[model samples]
Target: MKLLIRNLSRATTEAELQAMFESFGAVQSCNLVKDKTTNKSKGFGFVQMVKNGEAKAAMKTLNGKDVDGFKIRVKRAEDKPTEQPLQDAE
Candidate 1:
């Protein structure tokens, strides 16, 4: 299960986030969004849990939880559809 985490502090690191979730269950992957130019945290990230039950439990316990003065929001990441280009007929 993929979990979307938002409202994170700029100082938050991927390792810190992973450790926090590891207490609940195993984390398959952890990522923190960053700006291309600034290379700084975008205040959000995604975490992948191997098990659905464990992911759900982590979300339940972590949502609205404060970390470094920020109350983060945790939820299942929505699957984004692939973009397709329009075709023109002659």
Candidate 2:
């Protein structure tokens, strides 16, 4: 399951984020969003867990939990809707 983590501290790293979720279960992938120009954390990231149960557990425990002075929000990541090309007028 893919989970979205928000409101993270700027100092938080991908390793630290993975560690947090690893306590619950195996983390398939952990990523911290960064600024393209400055290469700094955008204060948010995504974590992919191998199991849905573990993901739910992590979300339940970590959501609204304070980490590094920030109350992080965790929830299932929603897939963005794809935009369709406009049709030509007759």
Candidate 3:
């Protein structure tokens, strides 16, 4: 299961997130969104867990919890809308 984590600390690191979630279960991946220009954290991230139950547990424990001096928000990831293919213009 995938989880969206928001309001992350500016100093949050992928390793820290992975370590935090390890207490719950196996985490498949931890990604901290970064800015294209500065390569700095966007103050948000996505975490993919091996099981849905584990993800849910992590969300419950982590949401509204302070980490690295910022209150974090965690939730089940929502499906992104698929983009339609562009039609050729005459």
| lDDT of every predicted structure (CA atoms) | 0.97, 0.98, 0.92
Error of 2 at 74 (Å): 0.4
Candidate rank order under TM-score: 2, 1, 3
Clashing pairs for predicted structure model 1, backbone only: none
**Model 2, range 1-90, lDDT digits (tens) per residue?**
999999999999999999999999999999999999999999999999999999999999999999989999999999988999999999
RMSD, one per candidate, in order: 1.4, 0.9, 2.0
Q: Sort by lDDT, best first.
A: 2, 1, 3
The superposed Cα distance between candidate 3 and the true structure at residue 23, in angstroms, equals 0.8
On TM-score, the candidate that comes out on top is: 2
Candidate 1: TM-score?
0.93
Which residue pairs show collisions in model 2? none
For model 1, the superposed segments whose C-alpha errors exceed 4 Å read 87-90
Per-prediction TM-score to the true structure, in the order listed:
0.93, 0.95, 0.90
The residue-level lDDT of candidate 2 at 53 comes to: 99
lDDT of 2: 0.98
Tens-place lDDT per residue, model 1, 1-90, is 999999999999999999989998899999999999999999999999999999999999999999999999999999999898988988
Tell me, by lDDT, which candidate is best: 2
| TM-score attained by model 2 | 0.95
